[model samples]
Target: MKSELRDLYQEVVIDHSKNPRNFRKPEGANRSAEGINPLCGDEITVHLKLAGDVIQDIGFQGAGCAISKASASMMTAALKNKTKAEAESLFERVHSMLTEGPKSSVNPEELGKLAALSGVWEFPVRVKCASLAWHTLRSALAGSGAPVSTE
Candidate 1:
């Protein structure tokens, strides 16, 4: 059963990486962020169209390993239609799960298919790969002048 779960996770990761949804910027995007993993040269640019507190549309463009690309793809899908506050909360939840450790507080199902990335914690070197886009999103939302750095 564990092996089956692992296989399923791998498939999810691959599918998203290969055919990412919302992979192009929307016209006249009001907000944007660029994220890069210097180690592997993974680069992502996230574009957002906001309607007040709600995220009306979201998209991205990037090249990266399966993990980084897939995470960004899933993130764009998950955050669309979400309020700014909700997006922040979701980001915090996923960030804690990846950087800290999984805990009962995290709803496993709420991660949707992104739970596939749980394996990333075991591969310490790839943690940044998984988090690059997330940090970028946070910086974009916060309007921070500092570069997004998860490490």
Candidate 2:
């Protein structure tokens, strides 16, 4: 990545981390789940309002590293109005990007601004921080009350 673009990505992550979006529980949320990253003490809760198979709304709340916070914020934005299948596909893409080595080919354009977080692949441990909320989202969508653990 070019120095200028890297700076921009860093700026996006920092901005989202400092003031995460959709960091509230929707009153009518039908599903919710919590997640923990034992390695970093990052805890997150994901809430979802589903209309049939589509996500009518999504939100999150928690505290963690910049990557975690930013990822959750971006996730809610990406998932709004998306179907469960679309969200699952997105989650899989992100999972591949995070775990399939840094060279993994996940199209940034397809992921939108969330592509900025791809830098996380460089730090294996930080990958947990970035993935905590995503796991929680999956659990929430499944209507499973069990908390997710990224151990």
Q: Top lDDT: which candidate number?
A: 2
**Residue 96, model 1, lDDT:** 71
Instruction: Look at candidate 1 and give me any clashing residue pairs.
Output: none
**How do the residues 71-97 of candidate 2 rate in per-residue lDDT, one tens digit apiece?**
999999899999999999999999888
lDDT of each: 0.79, 0.87
Instruction: List candidate 2 stretches off by more than 4 Å.
Output: 1-9
Residues 1-151, candidate 1: write the lDDT tens digits.
5864463347778898899989999886788877777777778887888888888898989788888888888888889899999999988888776665555377656788777777676567777987888888877777553555544
Q: Which 10-residue window of candidate 1 scores lowest in summed lDDT?
A: 142-151
Query: Total clashes, candidate 2?
Result: 0
**What is the clash count for each candidate, in the order shown?**
0, 0
- Models 1 onward score TM values of 0.87, 0.91
